[model samples]
Target: MDKANADFTPIFDGQTLAGWHAVPRLPVSRAPGGPEPDRTTETYRRAAQTTGSWTVEDGALTGRQDPPGCGYGGYLLSDGVYGDFELLFEACPDWPADTGILVRASALGSQGYQILLDHRRSGNIGGIYGNGIGGFHGINFTIDAEYDEQGRPIGLRLEDPATTIEPMTPDKTALLNDAASGEQFLSIWRWNEWNEFQIRVEGALPKITVHINGVKMTEIDTAAMKHPSYRQDEVLALLGPQGHIAFEVHDNDPGMGDARWGPNAACRWRNIRIREL
Candidate 1:
């Protein structure tokens, strides 16, 4: 596999996390009456638990909830902020792990646009989400798990068959384009295996594009985006033109039988390189 090549520079040293820091991550929203609970107190408590463990294993950067099955998660953030760049990385997440790559993230790490790597029931991958700006889901499909006889996840399936491509609607067409169909995505995706991901983000209200295993996933023009809770001006002010790149481990759901991260599960990432635009 060709790396970033001559035009890009490597960010991760492969031996150590020299330019990164860990921070507690939480779900947040900027919309009124949008489940934006007062988690400030909870956040303080969580920060004390752990920056959930981030370590280098087998040459890959791995992240997991400390002590596993714990309700909280964390983020590994780049020390420097970035703007208008293309990033390339490979990911291999354990089944049911809720993970993501964050772009233009705030110092705290949760406020940004996330490219979902939520490998679990009713989750979507290769989609854009408003991490803390509004919780907007810029996606058209959700992936679920297929189980073996003992109920261990053996493979994946689309939650809704119709979402295989999700027929283009006027509203969706206006916000995004060049999307890969669920069929197209599944055809190339290797279950329980490493997959390459490419993300390009540019401008303040950027146009975000994602490719998975060389398949064009989707493109979102934030400049023309329309969502009830997402205000371009407000998000721009909050995130600014530059922010840190972050790797996320989502908080475990407290509800009965709804685990976001599989017990002892971790997400592995490597070959992280970037090119400034």
Candidate 2:
């Protein structure tokens, strides 16, 4: 919102991406005589089979999702890792779906912070995903679902407590209470409409500030998170270098869950940008 700091520079001039490299999508191996194919393999195949589903149009980079295999997304990453930076972007999900902007990813999993764009009326919008303080940091919110032995949802946990004031699990895995504390941090926007998202990261101190539609929603202190893989110095060293920025299009095939109105339902995106601070 303020003038670019001395260490910051624009990565997208509102049209084409600058100071960033396009990590062209690559393909994964497929098994012989497999049933249909796994989602990851299909996703990588789509990326390799054609130019990415993303395109620069009308001063914005757009991501389009096609049916069949829910792959082909958008991403513009810095050539190097940045310990501190501010990322800004505007996105609009297709009539009935959601998407996410993932930062500090390890090319293995959603490790750092994810700005969620949920469209369902169920109130899962604008939440944070993956490693963060207080476990699953973001707007305090909860979903009712019963879990199987492996932690998979078997049915809605009707008796589950609200999500606020629930301390994160010791391993930083699950949210514990029923008070709805996490839901208080998000600013919900219109579904199927463009909304602005801002994320600020200070890698050294490992702090995060999230703003949605001009409303400051949550600020997380990573130092306080339950189970960290390393100490402050180690974390800083690992994250100090520039890393990849990615968009997560979770597997939403029909059998995975009720596909109606879920991420597999539909989704679109445009106008993505990031600046290194």
TM-score of each: 0.90, 0.59
lDDT of 2 by residue, 1-277 (tens): 7534444455556666554443333322221122333556655556544322444566665544433344443344445455577877777655334456656744432344566654432324445654321124444553333457996444322223444223333333232122123434323454346777787877554567777777765565556544333244444444444455665444333332332234344344444555666
lDDT of 1 by residue, 73-136 (tens): 8999999899999999999999879899999999979899999898877677898888888767
Clashing pairs in 1: none
Q: Could you report the Cα RMSD, in angstroms, for every candidate shown?
A: 3.3, 9.1
Number of backbone collisions per candidate = 0, 22
Which window of 10 residues has the lowest lDDT sum in candidate 2?
Answer: 25-34
RMSD in Å for candidate 1, one decimal? 3.3
